[model samples]
Target: MDPYIRIEHLTRTYVRGTNEIHALNDVSVEIADGEFVALMGPSGSGKTTLLNIVAGIDHATSGAVSIGDQDVLAMSDARKAAWRTRNVGYVFQFYNLMPMLTAYENVELPLLVLPLTRAQRREHAQAALEAVSILTRRDHYPKQLSGGEQQRVAIARAIVTDAKVLVADEPTGNLDAESEQEIMTLLKRLNKELGKTMLMVTHDSAAAAFADRTIRLEKGRLNTKTPETAGA
Candidate 1:
């Protein structure tokens, strides 16, 4: 089968003063549908850059990025934004939940951009909360929940749009050990059970262990390795 996501010769560069820095250097990788993969590297090693490119939030300096048969790198900014709303779900190191909104309302935000009615949006949001096993707390505000519960709500928000791919950057960076384990277990279930393709960038090997494979980067180059070989 073809890769669900393909990135070829991906390069990203930035100019500061007279110096040019390469954030990603001809990086090539493929992620299969329903597979869970982790990306690890030192700070400034292009992990987040690659994720942003895959999520269509940042443009590549040069390369080909295809998800399924769609050419992501070729899309216009407006097109990318539209595609992202439908195809991509992003989770940050920090849970980016709206503090004042209830968990259900926060999950409803993405569906508001679509043509769905208020009743439809509420149904979808409630189902998403159920998927993440947080439906009981749907009416709670972010501040009322614990760190783990907040992350679950954030995950529910990401999946409320029924996005096929989930890109997470340092998702467990702010959680306690127990909470981190809880989140990783939840992510693994999402990938293995719900068939959501996952690409996660994390510094923690224990967190990466939840993925089916682990790929490393150094100096902006792919250092591909299997989970067994990588000690994940």
Candidate 2:
């Protein structure tokens, strides 16, 4: 079967003054449908850059990216934004929830861009919160919630649109050890029960262990020296 996400000779470059920086260098990868894959690397390893490119928040300097049946790099900026709204759910490291909005309101933010009625938005937002087991805390603001709880709310916001792909960048980075474990367990359940394609970028080996396989990047290049193991 074809891979759900296919990246072909992907390269991203940046020019500042006279210096040229390569964030991604001819990197190619394939992720299967419903597969939970983790991306691991050190600082400045092009991890976030790759994630943003795939999520349509950033443009690649070259190469191609196809998520599911769509050629992502081929889409116009407007089309990419629309595609991202429908197909991708991005979970940030810091749990980017609004300070003023309640959890339910934060989850509902993404849906406001769609054509759905308020009732439909409510149903979807509620379902997403339930999925993350955060329904009970829906009325709490970000400042009122614990780090783990806030992360759960962020996850709910990510999936409120029912996006097929969940892209998480250090989802557990900001939490304590126990909370990190809780968040990882929640992510695992999301992958297993919801069958969402998970692409998580994390430096923590324990976090990567929760994934089905691990893809390591080093200095903008894939590390093939180490054998792929189960987090294979």
Q: Please tell me which predicted candidate would have the highest lDDT against the true structure.
A: 2
lDDT of 1 by residue, 140-227 (tens): 9999999999999999988988899999999999999999999999998888788999999999989988888888888898875533
lDDT of 2 by residue, 1-232 (tens): 5599998999999999999999999999999999999999899999999999999899999999999999999999999999999899999999989899999999999999999999999999999999989999999999999999999999999888889999999999988899999999999998998889999999899999999999999999999887776963
After superposition of all CA atoms, the RMSD between model 1 and the true structure is 1.7
* Residue 29 displacement (Å), model 1: 0.2
Taking all chains together, each candidate's TM-score versus the true structure is: 0.95, 0.98
Q: What lDDT, from 0 to 1, does candidate 2 have? A: 0.93
Rate residue 120 of model 2 by lDDT. Answer: 97
- TM-score attained by model 1: 0.95
| Pairs in clash, predicted candidate 1 | none
